[model samples]
Target chain A: MTGPLGALRASAVLAIAALATLLQVSLAPHLAWRGVGPDLALLVVVAAGLAWGAHSGLLLGFGAGVVLDLVPPADHLVGRWALALMVVGYVAGRVRADLRPDRRPALGTIVATAAACSFVGTSVFALSGLVLGDATTGVGGLLGVILASVVWDVALAVLLVPVLLRALARLEPEHAR
Target chain B: MTVLDLRPRSPEPPERPGRPGPGGRDDARRPREGRRRPVRLPRPATGRGWGDDREPTPPRSLVVALVLAAASLMALDAAGALAPVRGAVAAVAGPAESAVSAVARPLTAAPDWVRSQGALRDDVARLRSENDALRGRLAAAPYASNRLREYDGLSRLTGRLGYAVVPAHVVGIGPAQSFADTVTLDAGSAAGLRPDLTVVNAQGLVGRVLSVTRSTATVLLVTDADSVVGGRVGTTMDVGTLRGRGEVGPHGLLDLELVDRDATPARDDAVVTWGSQGRGPYVAGVPIGRVTKVVSSVRETAQRAEIEPYVDFGALDLVGVVVPDGTRGDRGVIEADGTLVPGEAR
Candidate 1:
């Protein structure tokens, strides 16, 4: 459903996504809090959704999630993150679709969306684990990871998303400042 | 438009403080739902501004299709169809990962330095890794004695278990890969590693081999959320399931659940692996951890104990993979005093 993004814009987006995955694998792991780290890739997907539209969001989220699943040190199933982030992307894109074209979103809105979407992404990942009968932790364990992820993602989103949004906005010729 | 969407949007045009929309009077009182809002606001634009109706609501079919795709991926991954693609990240993670860590170490160290304990913990992590690096260098050294010390330490360790062991270094940590807590090891199928091998350190049980590639294997640490090892109570010899707490805090511990509800687990009781059928995943008599807290549920009549593993998973450096073969030439002999004497010769 996506219009063909210009080759330059597509390459830029791919580079950013690769950079996000690189940081997620290397730098982010060192910054883990309580066994969960901030999800830079999820934030990138959220930005892609908001900057473009729902279709763009879905495709990017799905693609980025697959990269995360394939990357080393990820022992969980391959499709779990892909599924969770795709939902996040769609929702974030819907938020973009809902806003009046003239009115830009507040910083509060973006971070709030990130926090809400972080919860969704984490819960979906955990629920999939449960459905597969592979959920190792009980409810209490799930809650800790959920809480930790929300805190970290929210913290990073406030800093990362705005910069990412600007970069993504440059890709869209018609998008206003 | 998605009928499933329930997010509420602000219907009011509150942003244009000076210039109101030309359709302001008509745009009011409209229900602003996320996916179903099809109203077009009459706004004067220089051929660029998108109307509200122009906003694309992703087709529900697309969302459904993507979700189904994700589920299928999970199923395929669960069936072990994605094993070849699993450790591809580690293969590409050589100098790039190391450079990122080295460059960011100061930035990561800054916040922790302000707090004394965090700094100390960082110091320990750094030193532990440095120790691992030194050991790696020592093993690569041309001198035979340098190899002997590592072999001596590992041989003494394997002597206690009476198993041939392959020593490996922890190459990387994985908090970035979602929920599972794991470490990438330098050893893989090349080191004679297969899935379900018992992994241990100088202190106690670390975890088991989850998956392996040609040169690198991922070890699912015992502290992961779903790791289960059969543990024997040190005092009573009652066998119970040792679960990785998964909730690692300043005080992380495993949960031990005995099969017999009547089995009483007391604090300070030692717990050891109860072994496996044919000794595949876990061997018999490896020190797992010590019970420090016992919590009993009166309603369910279930009792479980908390064990503090002897090894600090946070600072893992070196570990041994216990090969189940007992007939190996380098097997350690158990003395009458239960002291393991390292086997002699190459």
Candidate 2:
């Protein structure tokens, strides 16, 4: 993928990923229920996995997770997110391969993967907080956050998948090899 | 001719007897000639050729690359080399963030509009309730006239302290999960703010300055668990140490440990910083809070009192940082009667 057209597609994907991450960070907080916001970055990682396959998704997930860990108010060890998100991306990619390329299956995969990713991400975060003995860490809050995040992520997936996929399709050719 | 050749036959040598004629010799040479013919070689291998023998060790290379990448990331994170990278990322992200906000602005605005419509109704109801509450306060004002007079006296005392009051705005709030309970103020080093400067608001003591950049500073709110302030309680003249007990509600509960076990603390006794002879970070006579509950134990050397901070940490907006003149020495002064003295002019 070295031609001008390939470069365009790559840039588009990068831009989309960045945009999605920003939106997730800023907007998701507003939708928070009981101090648990939706993990939009996780959803984006899952979507990337579905679109591009395992290798790209894992790499992208790792990078995005590092970025998330660097944001304000982060207390957990840095690489913790990197490892968890890589697993999420890889698993989402495998699941994507099994699903049909049709619109319904694509949407379904996005929603399901978003929920799974959120569960894994939040659990890892909560466990890290507990290990660090952070003052705000509480078992009840962790469970509440995980549950709320899953629901929020799933909802976002339902709305964002088609729009993202269509945008991606426009950037790439009709036939993908 | 046949009669003359009948008696002329003789034996031939063994080496030459079986020699083939010219035609037979030619046949024997055919196979040898075929072996001597030049053989044609296969075509040169192209870079993309299928039969190329030099295969890449893909798994080994990938593993090595991954390990190297991980090591580099860990090193960068540990050494804080990623700080500039993170800043660059934040810069780039700013525009992307704006673009995202622009696209989602309409969706976000709709909710605000809906919320405003709901707020209108809420506002009318709130006003009606407030009117009723004000009427009740007006009726009770006569009975509470003495309390108001006391507050007026306190305000006048604060004014006479000769402290130049500078009002600063709260620009940003730290996340609730943060253990530090810090807030960023718009004021910075340029605004006469220095580390360990005591911050207060209209209610009482707020916090102290932690770090200052050119245009901003991080203030560690007094509600943080780690914060400890040397203070004294009211005109009863008891010396105590005040420590934050984390976030319990709108106002943090300060644990006051008085130096004298025999000291009797009254309810609503004022708490002020135990200023060092005009040289501590906090100035004396700054109202910290009031004693809420007192715990007395005969075995313990010091009595403990629970203090309710006057400052509402949740709704904190404007604050004042006491800028001590000259040296950053101890500014607190303790009087002979055990009460904290107000600001001492250097």
Best-fitting candidate, measured by TM-score? Answer: 1
Sorted into a CAPRI-style docking class, model 2 comes out as incorrect
Q: After superposition, which runs of candidate 1 have C-alpha atoms over 4 Å from their true positions?
A: A1-11, A175-177, B1-55, B93-95, B111-346
> Least accurate stretch of 10 residues (summed lDDT) in model 1 chain B?
B1-10
Reference-based TM-score, model 2 = 0.42
lDDT of 1 at A131: 82
lDDT of candidate 2 over B136-216, digit per residue (tens)? 999878646744543343344346443543345678888877656889988776665678877777677888889888668
Per-prediction DockQ comes to 0.22, 0.04
lDDT of each: 0.75, 0.64
Candidate 1: tens digits of C-alpha lDDT, residues B1-346: 1111211223444334345445574543333334234434344344343322333666677778888888888888889887866756567754666676688888777656667687788899999999999998888774455445545565676777676676777899887446677889887776567899888876778899999998788998887888989899988999889888676442458999898899888888889899977986898888888888888888855678889998778767677777645322233433323244454454
Residue pairs clashing, model 2: B275-B332, B275-B333, B276-B332, B278-B331, B279-B329, B279-B330, B279-B331, B280-B330, B280-B331, B280-B332
User: For candidate 2, lDDT tens digit of each residue in A1-177?
Assistant: 221224665556556655656876666555567767767667767766666555555665666677665544444445556655665666665665565433324566677777877788678667755764632757987787788878887887898766665555554443332
- Give each model a TM-score: 0.46, 0.42
Q: Chain B TM-score per candidate, please.
A: 0.51, 0.48
